[model samples]
Target: TEADPLADAVAAAVAEANEPQPSAPTGPPLPGGEKDAFRVAVGQCWNVGSLSTDALGTTVVVAVAMQETGVPDGGSIRMLSFSGGSEAAALQAFEAARRAIIRCGARGFPLPVEKFSQWRDIEMTFNPEGMQFR
Candidate 1:
């Protein structure tokens, strides 16, 4: 049986074309000033003074939707996931994280406007470990 070179080339071309194209360029996973700074800002407001022992032991990921003015949409704040503790503990931790954002968010974050899309939908992690409890 003779190999069909044309058929193979056509298949390869179709496969390449079907592959998804890369989206716009974005920042690296870490060390990028914008994202790092954003996290730091949120962390600065992460108050853990009244958190319970179990809550303090848990870690959670908070999902927040942001407005164009750098303010978070109150209704859109939710806990996406958690670890290191029970569901009850996670809820407690999640509340702490939510309050943090709300507290410091009164005046809105100072993120750049042009990069709205990047910070528009944020999923931030809250780890109570290693944090100073007052």
Candidate 2:
């Protein structure tokens, strides 16, 4: 048994080398949340808004829009509008805008209409005509 100490060492090394490395965490889960690509797009859009604000506000806007409109462009427009409205009016406007955007061709996913109720948050009604929401 003592005839091959070097062989045992080599076997151990091979075993260690063959073991899989731990994968990097892919960040938090995102089933009912915004996708990563969409988040980056939203960040780029927010930077263009010239507003000094926090991520939470931006995140809320993006999430509500995505949940309501599905189209990236439409969601951004709605959020921008909702941001400036009074709280109560904004919520009402958000619901109205969501219905409008859906009617205008924004599609929902993962839950469909019956399952996912339209968002009625005050921060969801940014609709300026002639501006691009595509």
Candidate 3:
């Protein structure tokens, strides 16, 4: 039997429609800023200097939740995931990130309110090897 191009096209269209669509940004995103600056700001607010060299290679993903008024939930910093290094290292990294949140203060996270919507539920991956935002 010959191929049915119409059937193929219909199937493709249906498949595309069924595919999960990316969610729209909850709020406007902030204009591009230096990620390094953001990292430095957080680093300054917390102390993670005691971790051993091995732990320094770990990366932890931290999620911060914000409220409607642009205020972050006081205890919303959560360890979503991690990569590289041992479990202990990952735990240390997670704690460090949390401490940064606590110490930095949600309202002073170095992000403008203009970007609050986008970051209301943002996850930040912190790599300890170089303190870079991945």
Q: What is the clash count for each candidate, in the order shown?
A: 0, 5, 0
Please report, as a residue range, the 10-residue window in candidate 1 with the lowest summed lDDT. Answer: 22-31
The C-alpha RMSD of each candidate to the native structure, in angstroms, is 6.0, 13.8, 7.3
TM match of model 2 to true structure: 0.25
Q: Which model is ahead, 1 or 3, in terms of TM-score?
A: 1
- Under the 3 Å rule for N, CA and C atoms, how many clashes does model 1 have? 0
Report the C-alpha lDDT of model 1 over 17-93, residue by residue, as the tens digit.
98765433244332388777777777888888788888888999999988879898988999999998999999999
Q: Estimate each model's TM-score.
A: 0.73, 0.25, 0.66
* lDDT score at residue 115, model 3, on the 0-100 scale: 57
lDDT of each: 0.82, 0.39, 0.71
> Per-residue CA lDDT of candidate 2, range 1-134, in tens?
35698898999999998886533223234444543343333322322132223311322232243444444245444544335445654455444444444444344333233322333222331333312244
Off by over 4 Å in 2: 1-81, 106-125, 129-134
Specify the highest-lDDT model's number: 1
Candidate 2 local accuracy as lDDT? 0.39
**Measured by C-alpha RMSD in angstroms, how accurate is candidate 3?**
7.3
Q: Rank order by lDDT, top first?
A: 1, 3, 2
lDDT of 3 at 37: 64
